[model samples]
Target: MNGIPKGRHSGASKAECRPFLSSTERDVIRLVHEPGFDRWLDQIKATGGCENPVYLAGYTTVQRAETGEILRHYSTENEPGGRMPVRCRNRRERRCAPCSYLHAGDTYQIVRAGLSGGKGVHDSVQHHPRVLVTLTAPGFGPVHRATDSAEVCRPRRNGGLCPHGLPVGCPHRHPADSSAPGRPLCPACYDYVGHVLWHALAGRLWARFCDGLKRCLASMAGIPRSRLGEQLRLSFAKVAEYQKRGAVHFHAVIRADGPDGPNAAPPPWIDTDFLENAVHSSAATGYVQAPFSSATGERKIVWGEQIDVHPIRGEHFTGEIVTPDAVAAYISKYITKSVSDAGGLDQRVHTYEEIAYAPVNPHIRALMATCWRLGALPEFESLRLRPWAHTLGYRGHALTKSRRYSTTYGELRDVRARYASESIGASDTLTDAAWRYVGSGHTPGEEEIARAVSHELRVARESYRERVTDE
Candidate 1:
């Protein structure tokens, strides 16, 4: 490794091998000889030396709300550097790994809380009718897909051709890792315009599915649709994940609770069988029509024919009921993978031509081109499809939950703030603070130290967890 270009290094320690260092690293090392070095290092270490931390110049003063007496005062003037740094807090892994890890942890806690009831939910809610369901997009056209066995994708008994004189069948078995699977058999025959528009409206499609389910439940119970909400409330925590075909689908955990929330027992009419049927019916029959455009008339969208609903049972961590744990783990894994696996650019495209030069797969590029093209139409202006071209016209959060599903992200962060600092408290408390953003990120040498510190902390944490588990 040392013989390779850029990988060469002296056998001595970095401290002994390096004859020169950047200004930032030198400044940080000098703080070791300064007074109160322990306190300064502790503050910086608290953030795990985040990959892209925000630097701020600020002063905060705490005062008694009633008497107006100062309780405490703090400023960045006394710190090692004349600025305080906070984590960049981006959830996308490509943007910031440390903050993305934090976001994933919070998401796991949120989902687990709803599943087994904790963190602001009643434990008894675990007994409620709960199940995980998947909603996939309908097929736009036949594409290359490898089956489990010797079957080929779109094998034609008699060979056929598309409108553009391209073959309609694929004979070769495409490897999963190969880009051939997602590419259309004939690109000219693919409904790229509808694909982009469907994703642009996938969220609304989910909403219509939910509404349709409610209507189905009311029909099943022999009650009016309007009166169903009074007896039972449906709550869900869903995340959108991209399929290999560069389309988005939803995996959601749905629960039927009482009128109040997870704390209350659902109406007597609610049961696992009934809920399952409702979900299936909704996905099958629910439909929404998009507006007509210049090149095409109105199009109706429906969930794909395939749907899966698995009933959740028993406790999360105990014997006889390991499904909940698997569900929670699956969600965490999906959220992390979605950060980079969507096959689209993590950043937005500023122009239509940018899609052509984007470092992405052809599937995503085609979808992006469709977005930019359709977005230019005056009738589609309200969809804002152009801005989300990076996402292939999808503009929805990776994670979404019902209002009463569980605690919120804001609440989770507030709890952490209260635990980490004494400054956080009731909402009514008065806080006088002013901060200006100085900059973000470290010099090359400074980043080297930060990465080392982060690695050490991770190793320490894993070791501690192993010991605790063994005990």
Candidate 2:
């Protein structure tokens, strides 16, 4: 009944003349006619129209601890289908756009708190030395890349060929969004094994880099390594992003605090330039040796040559320095991105056949296959390349931070939850809650309706933002 063809074609037979409706349309009608439709709609709105909301069946009760009086009570017993909807809370945009949008906002706040302090962090952190750092993976082979300044992809005055007989240079100037940029010039010439192994050890390399930075800082201060922590503490928040060439790189906000933590001021010797120098030195010198395999031998993992360290500035600061807001927004943007952004899959692959059948370009497929092949080796079992084949062997989380860097995601969510719901009691409440997952996802028509609701909510937010900007 909901926009489905109510009448058949003019030239059709008796069966064709019957009113036709899809299962989704019938379900929509049934849903709207139910007594709990309004409550269901309200529940969806509460979840911000989550694409795949989980259904929960249970209740919560709060009572005054000393008075023995009930302060609040809530239950899903009367909800639609005897359950209430809650957001799936997936951070990947490809998985749930609504939840990811919310996650991105939280990420922005978390990163911003580190730079400019809020959400339980002391404001004194704003004065600390902060820098935006970019760490990249070493190149595995010659791959086409988008170039700025109108430069050719790989111009060569003397045309030459690789061992595989493919031209070693390209004269094309690819656009920033072109798919050809990430593809290797010659697939046969690419070091697929080396690329996969590097991805597997990227997390270890980052750890080594952090340790190297601490040593470098100690060396510059002319102090023993053991005593460095007594004078300065390095705090950072980082996000991993996949490059178009399928390599994972990191963007981080590094801050220098005193020995105590963010509330304490950094030492007089510490500054943006000081941190930048240490970052450059450590990135250059730091290395991690991959687990020795008889076939691959010992491979050393190190940061790429192009390390970008930009000093982070306050809002009023000018010139080329990146502002705190810019840094926060930059890191937040990457947290929602998955390996799929690099032409890879977000889901895990179980077998070689699954990797072969995955809907990905040849380069990504090759990387996955390489991960699977390498994962079988006893020496590389810890890397779990097979399980993470979908991500091209990169196993680290999308975002990570030092303990002193900023507020956490859990804290942010708790704040949001408290804001959404009224306080149960001042400090004298005893709360008990019981919940069980009932189901997830939506019927076809419900999916359509939820998407519409999500779009409308997004539009309302944008309109409100524009109005605020205008004022």
Each model's TM-score, in the order given?
A: 0.87, 0.93
In the range 110-210, model 1's lDDT, one tens digit per residue, is: 88888898998999888889888888888888777855557777788888888889888877787687777777777778889889888888888999999
Show the lowest summed lDDT stretch of 10 residues, model 2. 1-10
Highest lDDT, which number?
A: 2
| TM-score of model 2 (CA atoms) | 0.93
Write candidate 2's Cα lDDT for 415-436 as tens digits: 8889988866568898889999
Worst 10 residues of 1 by lDDT: 1-10
- Evaluated against the true structure, the overall lDDT of model 1 is 0.79
Against the true structure, candidate 2 has what lDDT? 0.87
TM-score of 1: 0.87
